[model samples]
Structures are given as C-alpha cells and as structure tokens.
Target: MYLLLVFRAMRNFIVVGHKATTTPSFSLEDIPGTSGRLDILCRAVTAAFVISHGIRKDVCVYLVLLGGEIPKTIRLVGETLRHLNPDERTTAALLKKALAVPATPEWAMSTSGIFVRTGGLAEVLTDLKDAKLIYLREDGADIRGLDAPGKDSSLSGEAAFILGDHTGMTPEEEALIEQAGARVVSLGATSLHADHCIVLINWFLDTNVFMSG
Candidate 1:
C-alpha cells in the first residue's frame, strides 16, 4: 500500500497541457504612481535588460527608477554634444553597457560576493513564478532560438519530475528527464550544474509577459 500511495502521489503531480491564458502586453500606464516618473526610452531599455537577465525579480523594482533617468541622460547628452569630453562620453557608453547585463538569480544570492547555495536557486525561481512577477517556461531553447520553432513544446512527465529537483538526482534520473520532454544541456561534461533553467526563464522574460504591469 505504501508503494501504491507513492505511485498515486506521483501520478497526481504529473504535468499536462492545461491551457494557461496568454499574458497581456505591458503598458507605461500600468506602472503604479509610486514607481516614479520615467521616460518611454528608459522604460523600454530597462524592461529589455531585465528580461534578458533571466527575469530576476529582485532587479525589477529598479526599473521604476531607470524609467525616470532616461530622459535626463538624453538631455545631458544633447546639451553636451559639442562640449562633452571624450573621457566622459566613453564613461557614459560603458555605463550603458553595464546596465544591459541582466540580473540573474545567482547574482541575487551573492550578497557578500560569495557563491550562493545550490538549493536556493530553485526556491527563488518558484517564488518569482508564483508571484506572477516572473513567467517560467518549463524547458526550452536558448535565447537565440527563443522565437524560432519548437519553443513552446511541453515537457514530458518524466522530464518534469527530474528537473523539479525534489532531491539530488542522478545520471539515470537525468536520462529520464530527457525522455519526458527536457533537453539536458551542460556547460561541461564534468559540470553537473543546471544552466538550462536560466535559459528558460530568460525566454519567458523575452516574451515580455511580465513587463505588462
């Protein structure tokens, strides 16, 4: 009966194609007044950067500030077009590049610049997804092919359990995950790290589902 109960529990948790409604598009008016005033250009840039960085929820709050600063930056650039020093212009360019990098879950965990514990990554993703602040695509392609073919395909039952990471999974477990609809992408053969999870998060963000608000 114990084994049967376990089987039943597993069966109940299986993922299937349930029609989830499409997320609405983001609009500037949707932002709360408390978020502060921002120009359209900055809002667009901040949204793009946040989505690219794996949909890190911690950084989303900063978008409110970025929205306001964009116009100021543009005004500064226009005012100093002729008088701007080469060094200052270069510094501004570098700052723009720095803002382009998306904040990741790992980066959020590094409070003191140290590596975050492995267990924390899954929790962060789950919380973000639950809050509706971040949308999660189960298992998908890299950023380049996010819009291409076979992107929204659902993962198989076995694959969902394996990637769920209830406890430490093994090589055999990983094989089962692939069989269920997941693609096991590794940075290196020796590295057991799960990088594809981040890829899926980025894909969701790229779709701009969460940015609507």
Candidate 2:
C-alpha cells in the first residue's frame, strides 16, 4: 500500500490469473475456502490494507485467482478501510476474515477494506478507461535517463500502472496489455523487482534525484 500512497495518482492494481483455474470470469463470492488460492491471496490483501489510511480515500487492489479449484477475482476497495491496525498481525487476521466471506458481489467488511468482485485486468482497465484514466504498462523501454526529454511529463496526472508479480507477466498477460494499448515505460535497464520499481517511481516523481546524471 505504501506504493499506492507514494504514487497517489495510482489508485488501482490488478493481478492477472494465468495459471489459476475456474471459469473465465468468476466472482469471489461463495467459493469454498479449499477452492481458492489463499497464500498469495492473503499477501495481496495485506499489501492492500498496509497502504490504506484508516479513513478511506484512494487506492484499490484486485486479485484474479484463476488457477485454483474455483476461479475467483477479489477486490479491496480503499474507501471502506476502517479500524484496521497497520501491523502484520492485524492484517493477517483481517485476511483470514476476508477468506471466509461468502462469495457474493456484496462488499465483505474487513478491518481494512471491502473485498467484492473478481475482475480480469482487461475488464478493470475498461472501467478505468470509461473513467478517462491514463494507463501505462510498467515495462518495455527504460525511462531512467530520459527524464529531461519529456518522458517524465507523460506520467503527469492521475493514472494507473500495470505491474506483475515476482514471476513476471506471462505471454497471455502481455497480450491483454497490448489490447489495452497501455503505454510501456521503464525505470532502468537492470531488472528490478516490482516492489523496487514502485519505490523508484515514487522517488523520481517526488524529487529530482533521478534527473541527476
């Protein structure tokens, strides 16, 4: 969530489901606990709450667990974040509670936010597009040394960036990105983890450190 807070303009995150199994589009409403992938799901939930303020404002996270016993997509809306202690333990407990919520589109209240939908990256981007938000893919050409030439200027205003997990985006995921026409931008030539990329993006945006040769 620190990433979300740092880049305040970035309000959405979508985890594509490549290996996960279920229907093509499934809501995370009522699947049995044993049906969904809880490990990574829990981690995503923790990350969502960690960055959210006690009083909701921005930030929304989506998880698409398609390879599990049942395909489920989860959403944690930042607006509903309340009474959540910003600690590892509390986040874990909240995750447990979310996992048990009945599979329904209705928002499931957690100590932090509400989990209420299973949406693919394409679907989510469509929503953002309808809202007129700029979308960028956080990969492809490096933007490290191009700050002075207007590359950084392209990032101005409210926008959303697409980032993959540790394993990176699969070929199928890339295809969907192409369909969305998201401009590809990079931080550096060296491959950095997704988390590091977020920090660097924020640092560069908030200060001129990245512009120095």
Candidate 3:
C-alpha cells in the first residue's frame, strides 16, 4: 500500500548492472574501469533527479548490482535525499558510501536518503508490482506515442523505467524483464547512453508529450 502510493505520486528508474560490485570495495576514482561500469549507473542516478535549482522529491533511482552471488540494491529517494551533486563522480561517491555500510536483509540507511538492501531484479519487480513498468530499448514502440509508457490518468506520469548497463542485459535478464510485463519502448532509431535516455524520458513527461494527440 505504501509503495503503491509512492509510485502513484512519483517516477521510478531502475538500472540493472551485471557487473557492478555488491560490496563497498569499488574504487570511486575509477568507477567504470574498476567498479564494473558503475559509473554508468552513477550518471543515470544523477540524471534522474537533478533539476536546475533543486531535486525532484518525487523521483527515485534503483541500482541493481548483480556482480556478486547475492544481489545488492540501492534505493536513492529524492524526497529526503540530501548532499547530492549534479556530477556523476559525486553520485559515485555517494554510492561508495552506501556500499561501505552494512546492508542487512532489510533496507539500511547509508546516508540521508540512500537505502541499501540485499535484492536484485526480481526484488525490484516485486516492489513495483502495482506500478506501470516501462522498459527502455533500442527497438520497440516509439515512447512518445504510447500510453502504456505512462503519463495517463492512472499515475499522471510513467512509473518504473528499466534500463541496462553498457554491456546491456543478458538473455536471462531480458527474460526476467519480459516476465515482469515491462513495456518495451524506444527513444529513437539510434541507441543512446542510459543517462541520456533517462533525461529524454523525463523531458517527455515534463513537457507533456500528449500534445501530439
């Protein structure tokens, strides 16, 4: 019930990483090279909530790390989020702090608004079971023309957006996303970085893409 309420009032971005470490051992200085492309996830996190003068309290970013045997998830809530910077490295630093803390079976707070827990793609899907799922892809229905992609009366905007890292989702990971009923939508004919895709998605919703209709 709480999650449903949150989803109805906010937008969610979930970035799945196949190689991001589940531990705090990742080096912040070299995120992409040492942290298994965690820099990509960091950039996506920054793009999700950093507005011109303030952060969107209604936004959230879920980092699903699948490098270890047990998956780790970081939930960055914008409502209570503080000390966030617009750059990727600063966000990476925040992630590093979250990873340094101990995440129990349940969600543990690493900072003001960051929560870390033990779960991955399956866990995220369950958490957002009641929300509309948007799967960002290179070849699917164009995002601007679809209602399944959100911005309808149900939630007023899109719910959860699922994305892949630099290497993209594995065949099995894709299967899990398909089973979750995520609507695959494309931004354009050419593929863009995950961070860039996020900014575009936000723009469509913020500017009311329904103007075309």
Kindly report which residue stretches of model 2 are placed more than 4 angstroms away from their true locations once superposed: 1-10, 17-56, 83-89, 105-112, 130-139, 144-153, 208-213
Q: After superposition, how far is residue 81 of candidate 3 from its true place, in Å?
A: 0.5
Sorted on lDDT, best first, the list reads 3, 2, 1
Encode model 1's per-residue lDDT on 1-213: one tens digit a residue: 355332100000111111111111222343222222122223222332233323222222111112222211111111112212233233223323323333333332211111111122233333233231211223333323322333342221111211222123445534444444344332223322222433433344335322212
* Model 3 C-alpha lDDT per residue in residues 153-178, reported as the tens digit of each score: 32254488899988877888788888
State model 2's lDDT.
Answer: 0.51
Q: Which digits, one per residue and each the tens of the lDDT, describe model 2 over residues 1-213?
A: 355334344445565544543332323343233333333444444444354344225556666655645445556676766555654345434545554665554445544565645445666676667332322344466654445544644444444556665456777777777677665677655676544554455455446533322
The TM-score of predicted model 3 comes to 0.88
Measured with C-alpha atoms, the lDDT of residue 156 in candidate 2 is 47
Clashes of 1: 4
Candidate 1 vs. true structure, TM-score: 0.21
How many Å off is the CA of 51 in candidate 3? 1.2
The top-ranked prediction according to TM-score is: 3
Off by over 4 Å in 3: 1-8, 147-158, 209-213
All candidates: TM-score: 0.21, 0.62, 0.88
